[model samples]
Target: MKRGAETRTERRDDAPRDHLLDRLFRSEAPRLARFIRKSVGNQDEVQDLVQETFVSFVAAARTGKLRTPEAYLRTIARNLLWGRARRPQHRDALHLPVDEDFEIAVAPEQEWMMEASDFLRRYEQALAELPARTREVFRLHRQEDLTYQQIAERLGLNVRAVKYHMRKALLYLDSRVNTDD
Candidate 1:
């Protein structure tokens, strides 16, 4: 067999038999293994998890229940990693009461996210109302990290025009953002 070639085997017969799966495996195996190794932190077990993921994929493909190859592989890797974590030996490695010194934190919930989303909407609305050239000048300065002189040079405008655009953008944003708050 040539280097990097897959060896056809009988175990793969039960699956729906797509050449794409072989192609995907060859192309994605290294990346899949790296992702698993990052989560599990075990150099030795990384290849094992990747193999098990493919085995699961073959089983899933047999059932005609496959989705995107990358997503399917990720789901399988996650399940296998969680299974490893649930083992009795590993489970008991942490038995704890609360650590008062280090408080457990909760993920940000819906209201905070909604407020942020609303703010972004208002900000976008404000930006959208700016004149085209003025908006471009402001974006070049802020987003592209260009100085006023550089922006002026790029847009073929004088430095005073660039500064005027910057001030205009800032004032509009300030008015909109403050009123919204």
Candidate 2:
């Protein structure tokens, strides 16, 4: 009613968006987690994904673009869940050139060559550093096309021991392998 005084709607419209997000998180988090858990089957990751959903919703809400906060949040959550569902399969899916009609000339840079060389050296070093038996079992099984039973017979060891060493070698290599390269 007074000049220069904000109306209730104006005050609410200008309120810090985080407070609204916090309120939404406090209220809807459990429901969202339960909803995600039914599909994801992991409680710990469900909470994290729900939090991520809230964060994305907050970012969108901060722009003051939503007409219905609750509905928008649920929609965002569903989309995030859908994306998660597709992520693993998508990564392993075969990726081909989008523009197959175009022939793009490609060349590796000197930096890339150097990185590749360094990566190979590191990989070799990691393999060399494994325990002798583990390295031998891994090399025999992977490089020599020998099965665990064959390696065990050749090495005069139990098949179980050969398997255990192979597993250890593989785990070690997996931890050391440079997937990015």
User: What is the TM-score of candidate 2?
Assistant: 0.40
lDDT of 1 by residue, 1-181 (tens): 6432443445465354667778889988898888887655557778888998999888876776544667667767866766665455543443347877977553333333344446656877889999998889878866545689989889999999999999999998889976846
Q: At residue 107, what lDDT does model 1 achieve? A: 33
- Each model's lDDT: 0.73, 0.72
Tell me which residue pairs clash in candidate 2: none
- Tens digits of lDDT, candidate 2, 43-157: 7878888889888876776666665666666767777765664454422333347696867443333333345455656778889999998899998876555678889999999
**Least well predicted 10-residue stretch by lDDT in candidate 1:** 106-115
Model 2 segments more than 4 A misplaced: 1-15, 89-181
Q: Which stretches of candidate 1 lie over 4 Å from their true place?
A: 1-18, 93-181
Best candidate, TM-score-wise?
A: 1
Highest lDDT against the true fold, candidate: 1
Clashes (backbone N, CA, C under 3 Å), per candidate, total 0, 0
